[model samples]
Target chain A: MNNFLTHIGRYILLMRLVFKQPEKKSIYFRQILIEIEHLGLDSVGIVVFISIFMGAVLAIQMAFNLDTPLVPLYTIGYATRQSVVLEFSPTIISLILAGKVGSRISSEIGTMRVTEQIDALEIMGINPATYLIFPKIIAALFFNPILIMISIIVANMGGWLAGSLTGMVPSGEFIYGLKAFFEGYDVFYSLVKSVVFAFLIVSISGYHGYYTRGGALEVGEASTKGVVNSSIAIIIFNLILTNLLLA
Target chain B: MIEAIEISKSFGDNKVLDNVSVKFEAGRCNLVIGQSGSGKTVLMKCLVGLFEIDEGRGIFGEKVLSRMSFDEMKLVRQEIGMLFQGGALFDSMNVEQNVMFPLSMFTEQSIGERLERANFCLSRVNLENVNKLLPSELSGGMKKRVAIARAIAMNPRYLFCDEPNSGLDPHTANVIDNLIKEITEEYGITTVINTHDMNSVIEIGDRVSFIHEGKLWWQGDRDTILMSDNKELNNFVFATKLTRKIKGL
Candidate 1:
């Protein structure tokens, strides 16, 4: 408990340091662009791949279970849509990202720490936290919602393809169910969760990396811890956000 | 000049540096030498403000280190440069970008101007035509030289090196030491080097501070160090067979 509190306190302090104004705006701006490429754009392939397969799997399962005469065939599409938008795309995709982007941030910064690159920055009068972390946060904040939105679109398309190809449900009925009673608020809720999860993944991983103390082995440990901790935070936050936003 | 006045630092219950005080002269190589755990590196880190001292203070030029706020310390640090043992060049950046990094962050120099200055610094280190190479692409000696270029790119008033020649051939180590000595003399930068390498101590140790068991144990230069009668210092100085043979002990 004491160690946990110490970590919390140190994390808060690090956040304060990380959010300071950049020493040079131009340099920071360049770094943000670079981070957007590294952290955000780089994750697109994995996000799209997972979302498409998951959507297809969810539709297939829904069709298999809801094939009774009492249930409407359109129910498959509706269920798939809800599952993709409200849960899978936003929540599961974020968990995947907590592993991908989270590990990258942790290992990169952890390597820097072990190599004394961070100390080099500090001795140069640069705020190492701000110089290294703020750009990642900004890049994630800016691009994560876009990634989630892409996941939503791509996953819905995958559901359509699965229904059409597998003959689980007719195309017209599936499209109608997809468009049926579509709540704009659900998409908004997913976006909100995405932004929050993005913050958690990047900042928590960065914290782990920033405090890394040893060499290559310790860096690997930090990376693993970062992914684990951020994934847990995502799960917990997903529960809270789903309750708050949906209920 | 840089001064460490009775500075002390401890990690948990392990006292790493205990009331260690020393002065580093400008325009000369100030070498701090001791065994592996003698707190030499800790003392350097404390003086550079990477680790806060539990007691005493550091004075950089006329500024009192312990009294300076974060902002004030940053402003003072603009006059400082450091070379880490591992080089610590930004791995993502090529050599040119690495050297120009501090200038881009701290100066209003145009890109062309920054490039010109970086080129000069690189050339001063006797490296050229490798501007596009990554740190991993360079040899260990080349990496150290690039690190030196980056360190001097800012035209710093002070330079600190922690084990500047830790991993290198004896010939390359001599090159690095002489380079550091030349740069120190040319720029009149207050230079502090933390090294256990005897070659460094004998070659360019304009002044030497010996730390033993977390305490400042002795002070002298290369000439006087060989003849010192201090027992611990003698043990350290004569630990190597070559030095033992030279000292006839």
Candidate 2:
């Protein structure tokens, strides 16, 4: 009972510390720049390409499913809006980010843990958790939303192509579909999922990497665990949010 | 000074260290000698706050490590320098960056100043003109030297080495031992080393503590180690055929 309480207590304390005032401890502007390059800039191409594909798929599916004469022209636009502002943009973007960001976090921290670089930071009076993990969490939080926004835009472009191909809905109708839902709720939902997913992936990967022991074998395990666990958590959370918001 | 009182550690059901206690003083190389699986590393880790003690208190100066707050312990930790068993230099950083890490974090020094100190330490360890090389490029001896340089970059008040001489040839190990001893004296830093090599016990075991089965079996200077009557200590100290022959046993 005590151990369980203590575990919860520690996690709460760490969360508060993580979310509390900005720590000047480990800004590591250099590392931040490197990670931003890796997580944000370098990842843009894949996210954009994936978004286009997702949008195209949604438009094609909607075109095939449409049988009602009254709403036939609205199908591509509605499908594009639903997928971009809600599920596809946030969920898919995060899944892709996990492969890039989460794996890098695991490898970097795992290498540090084994090399004693983390301990070296501690011995120098810097908190390894604060110095190493916090900046990563911050960078992920900072970059994920922006990347998600880009994903949504590219997906809309893809939907336009798919809509134009089917002749079921024109590119103009797809633009109209997006503008119709421009009450900002769709963007809000996407942002919400992106931020939450960012936190989950960065935090879990940090935890896994920080506690890594043993040798090369353990580092490899932590990397695999980081990607698998982060992906699973992202999906589970996505499902819950979709139900709660769209139900 | 550092004192560990009744330190014990275990892994699952197996107890690795049991009620080990001792005091290590400043400006002396205190060697913890034991054979493999004899709990030497556990004790050293317990002293360095790496292994959480099951039941013990580690007192460094006036601070009680077991009773410390996370933040408070971090403050004390700043004064510690450790050379890990595998010469845990960051593979990503060049030698200069590795040595400058602590200074860059904890000091107000400019980059120029940090680099100067890093270069000084590098040269002190007999490394020169190789600061641009990554850890992979360095030989085993050079890696250990770089680790030592990183440990002292902070001008730490205390130093702990886990098997500093483990994988090196005799010449390299002797050089590392002498450098550790010299640094301890020069900086007036308390140094603790964990090792099973009897050769180390003779080289610079200014003060020696013997651990067997997790207990502090004996404590003495290197000069008296060969003459100690304690069977456990004698067995470990004279386990080598060389020592046995000298003792005529």
Candidate 3:
């Protein structure tokens, strides 16, 4: 219990020291460029692949379950809503981001730790956590929801195209279904979830990466821990948010 | 001047440094020499407040780090410059950026002024015309030079180097040693060096502290250290076959 408390206490110290660091505006442009370069571009292939598959899967599942054959539009409506707001947009995006952003944060930080770059910062009177992690957090916070939103639009389009040609659903109903189901909560819910998920992913990964010890093998371990922990935390937090916000 | 009194550190049940007290005089190289895992690194860290001592006091000039708050410690840290074993250059930054990092962080120097100072420090370390190059582009010796340039860019009152000559050829190592010695004297900075190299000891050490079994075992100058009849020091110095052949021991 005491060890666990101290673990939490270090983060508090980390936060205080992070706050005390001089404003990192000097590195802002470089940070943003690096983040977008890494988190967005490096993961586009995976994001696209995941989103397309998720959308198609959701459409097929909803179509199989629905009994509204006379008005098949309900199948498309249910698929669009659930996939966009509940699962594909937030949950799937979070998973993809975890695979993308989390690993990079871990490895970059782990390398820094191994090379004593973080220690160099500390001795120079710079806060390593602030210098290293803050820009990443900010980039993840700002860019993730945007990426999620893009993923949603692209995935829904994929689902519509895939469903129409394959006879999984009728074309007339698919377009009408999406138009008719206008849940105001879809955009808000997914955006909120994306933001919170970004924080969890960035912070946990950064922590794991920064404290990496040993050598190359240990850095690999830290990277694995980073992705696994972030993905699990994102899922767990998803349920908590859903219960709180939806209930 | 830096002084450590009764400094001790442990990892769980394993004691790393035990009741080690040492003082570093200003305007000279205070060398800490021991084989690997002799607690030299831990002792150096304890002196710098990088690692907290289990029981001891570290006085940088007059203010003791053990008793100071984070804010107060920050003030004392301003007087410190460190060259880590691996050079620890910020890879993302260019040579100029890495050297100017300290100035930009602690001082509100104008961009022009910071660049000028960085250029000057780099020249002082004999690193020239490589300001725009990344660390990856530099040779191992060049990287070490850049780290030294960064360390002294702040014109610190105190300097510390951990295994500064590690991984370098003897010739490059000697050059680095001479540069550190020259800077220490020129700036009158109290320099503390953690080294295991005998060449470094003979070349730069004005005062050498031998740490053995987590204790300060012996203290003296390079000339005296070489001539000491201490059995352990003799064994350490003559461990290699070549050294043994040279010493006829």
Find the candidate with the highest DockQ and give its number. 1
Interface RMSD, prediction 2: 2.2
Per-residue CA lDDT of model 2 for A147-220, tens digit only, reads 99998888888888888887867777777776764657778888989999999888877766777898889998
Cand. 1 TM to true fold: 0.98
Comparing 1 and 2 on DockQ, the stronger one: 1
Candidate with maximal TM-score? 1
Residue A169 accuracy (lDDT) in model 2:
79
C-alpha lDDT values of all predictions: 0.94, 0.84, 0.85
Tens-digit lDDT string for candidate 3 (B153-239) = 999999999999999999999999999999999999999999999999999999999998799989999889867878788787778
How close is every model to the real structure, measured as TM-score?
0.98, 0.91, 0.93
Candidate 3 displacement at residue A114 in angstroms = 1.7
What lDDT tens digits, residue by residue, belong to model 1 across residues B1-249? 999999889999999998988999999999999999999888988888889889999999899988999999899888999999999999999999999999999999999999999999999999999999999999999999999999999999999999999989999999999999999999999999999999999999999999999999899999999999998999998998988888887
What is candidate 2's DockQ? 0.52
Of 1 and 3, the candidate ranking higher by lDDT: 1
